[model samples]
Target: MATQTPREAPAQAGRRLDLSAPWWSSPRWQEEKRRIRGELAALEARITPRRRLRAVIRTLARHGLLRLMQDRRAAAPSAGDASHGRHPHRDPDRRLRQIGRRLRLAFQELGPAFIKLGQVLVTRQELLPDPITAELAQLLDRVPPMPFPYLAVVLDEELPDGLQTFAWIDPEPIGSASLAQVYRAQLRDGRRCAVKVIRPLVDKLFQTDIANIARLARRLQRLLPPAVAASSDLPGLIRDYYSSVQSELDMRIEARNTREGRELVEEFGTLAVPEVYLATRRVLVTEYVDGWNIKDFPVDFFTFEERFERMIDLAHLYIKEFLNGRYHADPHGSNLIVWRHSKKVYVIDWGMVGRMDALHTEAIFRHLLHIRLNQAEDAAEVMLDVFEPTPYTDVGRLKDQLRSLYIRYVDTEQAGPHNWGHLLVEEIRIAMDNHCRIPTGLSLWAKGWSAAEGTARWLCPEISYHTVVESADVQILRRLLARRFNYRANAAWIAEASELVATLPRRLNKILERAAWNDFKLPVEGRLSEQATRNLNRMVNRATLGLISGSFFLGSALLAALGGGALDRIPGLAAVTTTALWGSLGVGVYTVWRVLRSNKA
Candidate 1:
């Protein structure tokens, strides 16, 4: 047999069929499944059952399942795990202090992902153990230094041509993290700056890890107990993680972040975001702000209260900027460096920033105020609104539960002078327990505020955080409300709204085209029975009334016949009743017919 030239084929006359199937159900899904299964099988070969079990549990926990089980197991009497065993020492506030320390240690052991997780965890005083939460509150993940050889490669790539373009490249990294590491260096022109290089395999690792974690989370959510599932918004948390962490892997995204963050706080003058240096991928260069670590700064320079208040004021300013506009997402202590020369706040690491819609800005501020006023019911509604709770839950019950929870624990005195973050955390946990899904933006917002509050408290123990936050509310509310009524012509807002509208039509067109191609199949099975039941009930009611009316008419006719033979007192009553029953039957029949016709359509 002669083999034809490989490329030759008979041309089909008709257009090819495009099934336009779902990604999961499609043939491509099988390929992905095969690839993932192979990876898992390879992993299975390397690890023991115990280690694999731990990995699986962690994976499930990452996805959002087995958290409650883990919590329960941790609380149970351990066989021999001394590391996590209950502490013997019982000082009045030792536990609180220890929590922060334990969290810091946990992050260190968990590696970059867990350190970042702990960083996020500490921000959310509302979700975890308070002592641990407070402790993790202070934890910082400064990236460890990378090898000089790799640094040289990055410098060469960044400068292009050769390393001779730069005058001096620092041997030591100023900062490091899981995604990328940063080093302080001087440019060829003698400008002092920082160079950030993406960790070689960080992106690939994150992509794979995130995929596995997301899969695990979905599985856990489906398999986990209702209470655990209710308590944690695991999927949302993962999604938020994806948005923040994934962006960190992209230097270009970081560059954009630097630009946006700098622009946002430009008006503050006292705050700074580093100026981005235009260079190649996996390498970013920015002006280095000469600063003292805010935590390590001289405490003796000002009265304790003044220092605390100043920090509080700065925090308020940061929150105002974030809530009112696009936020510098990672406002943790590591990212928030205080510039020594100018005494200005410098925000570094803009990889994770979130934007605020007018609604989010309003709702968050409103929620804060409601908390202050002790309006638990109102606050719960705001919580629901902020979280965008599903309609399945009872709003009234949630509100009542919130009221009870708030009434039980929101102590004005015990809450301390400047620890609103702790209070916010409590509120969130209660909401979570009551089946509320915490909004990612709100969670991050809460986390940032709590951290700043803690920092401010540590710096200025006498400064009342409540007072600072309340003052911010007054300022923002006054301005925002006035703006609402006045309807100031904001060019930026107009431009954004215009852009949004312009994008909508294209998005809608794409969605409609896709839907049309996919046969526009709506999920009607669920609704069908409901519609039928309602129609059927209405139909039965009409039919019953019709039958009753017909019986009355017949009775009246017989009564009339009896009356014609001999006048009787009941005959007149029976005639009137029969006439009324006949009229009812006529109406019922019409009603049933109408219901049937509507159901058919």
Candidate 2:
């Protein structure tokens, strides 16, 4: 046989982008510049008149290379070449979705702030294309960290007299993103923690780039095609882009958010929060969690199914607890840590917590049940309320449109599997384009839940969406009900109730005096409308009644579910409980039915 030689496989692609060495010092910068220039040149011919103008401005603004780069068009492929023209579009909607995906991919390749922006965009699903939103939701901040030397410089500047002050510092970082890098280290007292240090001089350049992007967003808000513009949230959407960028620059906020999240999740068993250590302007130190990434947990440690189920269960619990009270807010895979010893989830990094009020949280459960039951109209109403449309807007018409949109989205996905996160985003985007704005809390809640849902589905295919939804709905609602009951009994409520009681005696005295004088004819109020007086009294009655009713029902339910031997009080109450299980099933069935009807035509 003839002698043959085998070619070696290429080195891991990641090895090419090592961050241990300073990025600017790497000769790779030249290669990247060349690559970008080449891409820009190729992109030039495909650009429309306006987009070409944008391209030119962007190119100049990015590199200050005013002179048109070498035009290799003469040597390049003609328009007939596959690389020279746009991809064939059999379906325009698909093409639009592809555009969104491509844009997100571009941001991913750009690294850090852009990747963070993409992460934020996915969370703001109501303001972006469904396909785009879905794709962006997959964004992970996996950029290489700055060289240790540069990081050392940052620490030195921020710490005043440094290194000698600390007992031990790891030269390598555990996790790195576009904005900040986290390293494992120990204090002089031998306490183990991770120090997250921001990049040096990243703010000025990043802010400038962001300001330019903001201006571009404004211009595009006015210029995109009707369908395209309608598909995006634009200006309002990018408002937080700047805020997030500014936030990443300060580590103090992260310290505070993490501390608060720890306290919030502390009450829950099987869930833990990382403890924050010393926090300075540029660095935040927190207890190092000895846990595995939920998704990447070793199969040897647990079966595939076990891994998946645990992740899903963790997500369900965390989300319920979060929406019920405060949330870790951002529950991306990176933030999820599976503690091996206790088999609990330790969520870290809480810079972007979302607040859900009573009304919004309740509406979310209603929406979830609606989805589980597939009741289209009820779902639509909840969507409208969540979006908070204007009175002048034709909700009926919008509902019809939303129903069609939902059908299209559901139909487009394989096997008719719908992602709630993407669906919510689409619904929100539609509302925003039509002058509706969903509360930030609701949007974040949707994002967090969608992430949990997606992770759960990925972990356990046998875990039915309906079951997950129902379980979460029950727990969240129960917790919220408890909180409401507690609030009604709070000192504030006591004071208000006392004042109302005190007023009752004076009002009674007036009534008695009037009756005694036989001048019982009540003076008609002229300033206030009868309708206003009636409404106010009705509200007061409802508040008082609601407090009493909710507390009683909640207590009864708790006693029935958990109080040992309490069920034996009534004659054949066990049999009644057995029968009542059927009633509960019927309610669930009806709830799902309502959701389907409301969500569809």
Candidate 3:
């Protein structure tokens, strides 16, 4: 076929070019192209089949599930197998212990991702079985340090010119973990610092393993019981894990977190945060703080009173951070150090932090206020407002549990020297059991508080966390009231003075007009007659009863009318509506009979 050239096309237009649309411009073709492109993009984004298969295989092998299956099959009863008659699984205690041991080993073998998962699982004792959670609690992140040459290569890549700034860098690592290794180094300017280098390939491995774990978690959520699923949001857990891993992988982010934490708690002269010298995506250099881990610090160094005072100070600091909406999410004993000579507490490893919204902060403040006032019911109500309730939540049960927990911990007449951190943990567990979702920030705060409390307790067994919190509450209340009073003294005085000045003329005119009309008089009062008072009390009682009955009746009717929607879907709405209706009828009958009896009398 012969085609017309561009220059000749115009001249050939006289022959009438075909008016058909091009294929690419056709609507049908465009739609098909978009659909194909979408499909290809989705396929590319999804986990590859080979990668999925490999993950599954690795999981099964590392967890010993395949070996367990083999053992079960080999132990299965056969015609010639007489020993099969004995049921080894009859003792669930023994079987559970064996499973826990195997699971611990499996997590260790699976490396960092699984180890981190296990560490997280340890805090979910409410959702997981006790044995499993207990075993997972023992999972540690300690690992053999990578070679100095490899770490040097990473430092060189991260800071090519700046690497020379260090005069002496120790080849031996002081500590090593799944993600990073730390070494003591001296700068050319003679400043001693700790250099942390992220392990090569850790980020990539974490991405792959996290993806597989997330997929597995989704499947597990579907297969688990309703209570388990409600208690443990696997999807949310995976998301939080991803966030924490991303933060830890970026040394710059950690450095920022450290700086912010230092700024937040700098008011407390006894507390310290390491100063960051150099920060990069994979390398962090911070001032090397020489101190004893809070866990291992000798208690005899400080007197009992000094230890108690320090504990109270530490508790106050944590409470202040919580109120300010910035909290250290991980304040474990290892991350806390007590300086030997200065006797100051230093917080390290600021890889994970949490923030609270204004609403959450105010709610928590009110909750603590109620606790301090010994209003357990009010405290429970405030706490309920802080957490999100699920469709299956038993609000009454949750409230009751919270009230009881507060009474047990905060009510001094009922208990002595209670641990506030332990109480918070128990409260969270209760919330979980009742299908309430605690905010992530609040959960982290509670966990950090618990760890801090543990360290304090270890230092002084006689220290009481509840007492410390109560003291802090008093101080905070005083500060808040003082600030409020100061504001009112400055701002409210001007408004009040202006209002008085505006009303003074009107008041004077009214008084002068009344005097001119001779309407001003002093009034005298006589005691009310008994009959009039009785009538008034009767009317008030009737009106009060009527209002109460009306409210209940209206509420019940609304619930019944809306039963097809939200009311019907709720687990116990019907019972509540029925109770309201019956109670209203009972009250109405009692009111009517009382009026009749009074009239006859």
Displacement of residue 527 (Cα, Å) in model 3 is 60
TM-score preference between candidates 1 and 2, better one: 1
Per-residue CA lDDT of model 3 for 93-157, tens digit only, reads 44555566677777666556766777766655455556666666667445655555456556756
| Candidate 1 vs candidate 3, lDDT winner | 3
What clash pairs does model 1 have? 63-217, 100-135, 123-447, 125-425, 126-425, 143-176, 143-177, 308-460, 549-581
Candidate 2 local Cα displacement, residue 462, angstroms: 2.9
Local distance difference test values of all predictions, in order: 0.61, 0.62, 0.71
Candidate 1: 10-residue stretch with minimal lDDT: 1-10
lDDT of 2: 0.62
Instruction: In model 1, state the lDDT of residue 171.
Output: 50
lDDT of 3: 0.71
Clash totals, every prediction:
9, 23, 0
Give the per-residue lDDT of model 2 (tens digit) for 1-601: 0111001101221222222234423455435445544654564445344553465366444542232222222223455655423644434346445555565556654445567777776676655556766666656554655666556556644764454335556666687776778877777677878888887555644555566677778998899744345435577667756775676578888888777776766656657788887778888878888888767766577666665556546656666655655665667677778777876778877766666776676676676556556577777777776666653345677888777665544322211356565666666666765655467556777677666666665555565554555556666767767766876658778899899998999999999999999989855633444467766776566456545545545555565688658677667766665555555555545545644664631
Candidate 2 scores a C-alpha RMSD against the true structure in Å of 25.9
lDDT (Cα, tens digit) per residue for candidate 1, span 1-601: 0121101211211221111224323454445445544654575455443453465456544544334444334444445546442543433245445545644654454345555666666656666666566576454554354454444445554656445555555555667666667766666677877878876545544555566567677998888655457657677787888777767766888898788777777666556778986556778889898876667667664556546545655766666765566676556566667776766767788777766676666776776677667776776777667654543345676777666655543434323542456556666676666666765577666666666666665555665566666667667877578657654547667888999999999999988998989866656433234357777777687667667766766766666666654544445665565566567567657766775776742
